[model samples]
Target chain A: MTVHALKRFDNVTELAPQALVPADTSRGLSITAQGLEKSFGDNRVLRGLDFHVPAGQFVAIVGRSGCGKSTLLRLLLNLDQASGGQFWFGERNDAKPDKSAVRVMFQEPRLLPWASVLSNVEVGLGDKRGTPEGRALALDALRNVGLETRRDDWPAVLSGGQKQRVALARALVSNPRVLAFDEPLGALDALTRISMQKLLGQVWVDQGFTAIMVTHDVAEAVTLADRVLIIEEGEIAMDLSVDLPRPRERGSVEVAQLEGRILRELFRNSKAGEDA
Target chain B: MSAPAEKFSNLTQWILPIGILVVWQVLSSIGFIPGRVLPAPTDVILAGWKVLLNGELAKNIWVSFWRALVGFAIGGGIGFALGLANGLSRRSERFLDSTLQMIRNVPHLALIPLVILWFGIDETAKIFLVALGVFFPIYINTQHGIRTVDAQLVEMGQTYGMTRGALFWRVYLPGALPSIFVGLRYALGIMWLTLIVAETIAASSGIGYMAMQAREFLLVDIVVLSILIYALLGKLADSTARLLERLCLGWHPAFQKR
Candidate 1:
């Protein structure tokens, strides 16, 4: 069911991971955490959290505000150090993983206002920047986001949705093995959010990167993830696999049922906390 | 906003200055206003022409302009470098920023007496005063600019594997540019103010020195001519700064006219 978008993703030869993924194999990397923990002074954000995400799987972390879902995403991306416990990537678990294999799209577009759309995308190329191949890769990334024509324009001119698309392009340019998002569409309006979700889903299917997103929206969680993980009290409260067909309708019975299950799990814990 | 309205506004801006000149000329012609009190526009223009012919005006203007520029370069340069250092490193800020802030609180002009005593009213004392005068605004603004750069963007840069150098060039510098330009514009104004005071109090030759000599002789026309030159120079410096801001910060929405 989730495989429908795979066909459309194959036509783009330039970004289809040339020899990087060994042709037929997935470029995605699996992530495994063993008793992960983090705390900010007295506030324990991630308390003994444990989960394993397989290669190329789409995982959505859903929870209420202050549930440490965003904190978990940050730890995965190494934006913050874990106070306790160990986590490592698949093959890289045995060796020192290059940090380049992980990338993130923030809730804000975070596009460099001073850089042009193309140059902003090129910034993702890291050391490869300022080279012709890097330029071509950046242009390809822009094309991926349907912003190829706006390569020369400053980021300030683009709309919020368009800016996020450029940011997505920048994240995808380096072909990360694991991509995490921290409520990447939380700021968008309803219509733009829907479109962005669709774009994100399509990109994940095409890129075959291990996709993980932290969001509060239950419907968004069901509509996107292969597996939905609800976080509560700095722990994974519920782990449910979504088996619905491709392009799951937002208001459909099955999707709504899944969303309802996750929502109940989330509210139940919050209710319990309030009672105690 | 329309073409004709913009044109009218432009026209209105020049009308008052020109009108004042005309009214003053008329009053002076009728001898209602004496040349000793305030010279007529014609008298001032003639005085300006005489100085231009003898090259005194050019030499004085050059000296003042050079001093202002040299001071700006030295002060603004140190401000930029130190601000960048303090902004990028907390240790540096802890060590240097307090001392700098303490120095900033003292009025730079108040040091003129001490400066004259130390450098004997030579070019060094004058340049030091101007340099000190312009330093604080640029330093404060530059530090504020770098410090306030969105933390989210810095995090994003780090996750994307941007090296420290890459992050500085691609994110920190560009993000801080608008604020830096604000500093530059503010510093330019102080540059002229400090130069004028420094030159007036002492020195060999400049517009300020010329004005002092004119005052001693009671040459009101020459004094008025010196004032005009100072105004013109100030406007020229401001315009140059604005042009640079426009060029460097074209990406800023405030600067995008088109």
Candidate 2:
């Protein structure tokens, strides 16, 4: 599939209702990427990618490893800049200071081993510089994640699931506009993954933060996402919406159908890459 | 069952030292060891008490302790600064790390001949020697601690919008403290060892000099007493370090588990 040239959308007003706004103007960040291009030396990672998740939407991005799922997530968070194309948060362009309102959780529960579980979450508070406000905010965040009891406990003592829960607590405590997950539950066992998925879905619903999760699991994409955007060859291959109601079931016919469609697209994408 | 196991281990710990003392005391009582070469523990204790009462032993001990303290402060300060510089900057590390490593390989003691020549066998040479001895272990450990910090934590810090300075102070320093502490403990050992050696040479005062004098006079009891003093001081310094490590790194997972 040929990568279309990245179109730089000059102003937020030019796009449709769901077009991403520069966070400054919209007072919210609903991520939108259009013709996003990324390459590592000679290897193009993301090619002319485009998608939009309205505010408070739970979007799951699914693709095989090396299919640029993580690259896209990183792009949205500004952890990395795309080589070409325009990505917007809310309705504004990329230059706004409002980008601080975004946060991310990685697959590894990257809690500071030397810090207590509470302090790890409080890292999202970003620089107490010895302030009472920082401590209060950190405590509030720990309480939100239901980990206030383990606040004083070191992260090393936490079980794997508990560690991830602490990480989730950390992400939420910041009260970010957008929470991006880069395969957060990919490392978990089947049972833990299911519970975490349920917990995540409930948290997203309650918090009302626009969340974009990158996953390779078809069922996870179907069960959690409001829309599952499948990437093939570094470009979005399918942009299918999941109209399934809240408290989604993994075995629901709609979920199974969506999962099957994603799996088929994944296989086809792999073959296409192999042929290339 | 567990209580017996605990008692057995505790017994095992003390057995060797107790056994050695018993055998040594028996041999001394039997007169199998000459007093010129070997002194009984009781004789050594009596000699220690005599020196203490005369105030000479206390003065010597104080002199050596102060020297080690001053030297440790100076060398450790410079080592920490240089290590942080090299650790943080790849260019600085590439330029200086090899040279530092090479200098580290040259035993600080080997420089004593030149050091004495330069400083004329006074307090300066001993202090400089102690400083040099303490520098390497602290520097190497500090560098390792900083360099080996988890990259993921750094990235997390960045994502949270932490300033570069905040990143270093909060994430980097705490992460590096354990390795740095290890270096400090090792450096402390080197400080005492170097001070003793420095005091051994050309010193009118201090423990090593007094021990040398005792050896010359064939005062075996004083010699044994001085050696015991060195061991005790070393042990004291080590315990202090361990205590500090526990305090500073108490939030660490290892301590939390305990």
Candidate 3:
């Protein structure tokens, strides 16, 4: 089937708009990319990539700098145009997915510094921002992130970790089907990063949305993700299933083995490129 | 902070200005300063009283005040509109920026002779000059603010389903506010500066005209009064801007300073 140069999963969903998306068995949505491609001039960032992320699955993508991990997330998040091929969500792909059901949590809190914490969370509701229900939902999301008391405070006053938590609430307030995180904790200190990792994991468990996180930290990738996909030269070099229990001890034997495996693949590719 | 501490801090601000006033008054009264060339502070006060009795002082103040405000609205209104347009849309910038930049390079006050020739010694000339003086600061700062709104924030807003209009309201406008306020304060300073020049050069009314008139009669007290009035008005405008900044940018650390 012929596809447009830029496509967002605008097709009709097999299930109803509000039905379970890969979380409840009766209804499910999936992100399917078939030989998806992207390039900027002579530089090919993603070359014929393919993957299917089923509903409620937490997938972490890690790669060296410029490995197109971010590029893949951008394409999925509808932030950039794909050079060729197609990717879409839901059981059938024709029209794009519900726009409100997709969101991206950037590395920066991107919280409107001018807005209060609750108002920032309400930003995720889009048109519903002015509604009372939207306000209540935002407050609830803030509570889930343990920031209900700071709802009235400006985002500037909150510590860095707290700000990221507000950002997380903003992502979750809409009950989105797909949450794409672009290294949301990349700027955080080590201890703060660990706490944020826990919050991110708990959010996924409770929300049940499909999550795609791009990170440089292999340990974080192994700890939080159900599946870890390592990209090299714009292709998935390894797709390793974590197959571990929730709250998996960080740096445990199982986690370390998976981390090492993914790192070796990435390192081997970089060394090969250097030689060439 | 406690109320006394707050009051003490407030008093600290007045110390230098009050001290200067007291010293100047003592010097003038003691004959260390000549009354003709430089009037005593008391004489300046008496001149203010004389103007108050005749009510010309109010009329002149009103004229100058009105001129500044009207000019600000016209030049600044257009500037703000263009700034947002040019800042948000590259095509608009491409179409209009070079021309505006060329116009901006010409010092606005330098257009005085041409402005007077075009509009005569009327209110139009003064207001036009004032408007021209105030436009560039607002335009340049507002455009800079909008252009520099974090691209990441804009992208996040888009993914969250903000419409084009929503993006401006929720992201671009708030993001650009700090810089816009910077422009507003600067424009206010220029508004007074421009009005002073225009009124002093050619006007039958306004504080500047009164000052120019006093020079002929050597009523140095009224001249000093006019200069003092300009300082007070400038301070008033600045405080108002600061108050607004505090209200809007309470989230900012700089604005929240005690």
> Best-fitting candidate, measured by DockQ?
1
- lDDT digits (tens) for residues A1-276 of candidate 2: 000111111221122233121223232367777889999999999989877778777788898888899988888777888899988877666456453478888999888887788778778776452478767767765665556788888887788888998888778765677889999998999887887876676556455678889998889988888888988779888898888765567798878887888788888745566633
Model 1 agreement with the true structure over A209-252: per-residue lDDT tens digits: 89889998989989888899988889889999998977677899
CA shift of A18, model 3, Å: 26
Model 3: docking quality category: high
Which 10-residue window of candidate 2 chain A scores lowest in summed lDDT?
A: A1-10
Candidate 1: where is the Cα deviation over 4 Å?
A1-25, A272-276, B1-13
RMSD (CA, Å), each prediction = 4.0, 8.0, 6.7
Residues B147-220, model 1: lDDT tens digits: 99999899888888888998899889988898998999899999989988888888878999999999999999
User: For candidate 3, lDDT tens digit of each residue in B1-258?
Assistant: 899999999899889999999999999989999998789999999999999899999999999999999999999998899999999999999999999999999988888889989999998999898888889999999999999999988988888888999899989998999999999999999999999988998899999999999998988999999999999999999999988988998988777655
What local lDDT does model 2 show for residue A233? 75
Score candidate 3 by lDDT.
Answer: 0.85
lDDT string for model 3 (A138-178, tens) is 87777777788999998888898888989988887877878
Fnat values, candidates in order:
0.94, 0.74, 0.94
lDDT, candidate 1, residue A21? 22
TM-scores of all predicted structures: 0.93, 0.89, 0.93
For candidate 3, the share of real interface contacts preserved is 0.94
How much is the lDDT of residue B232 in candidate 1? 86
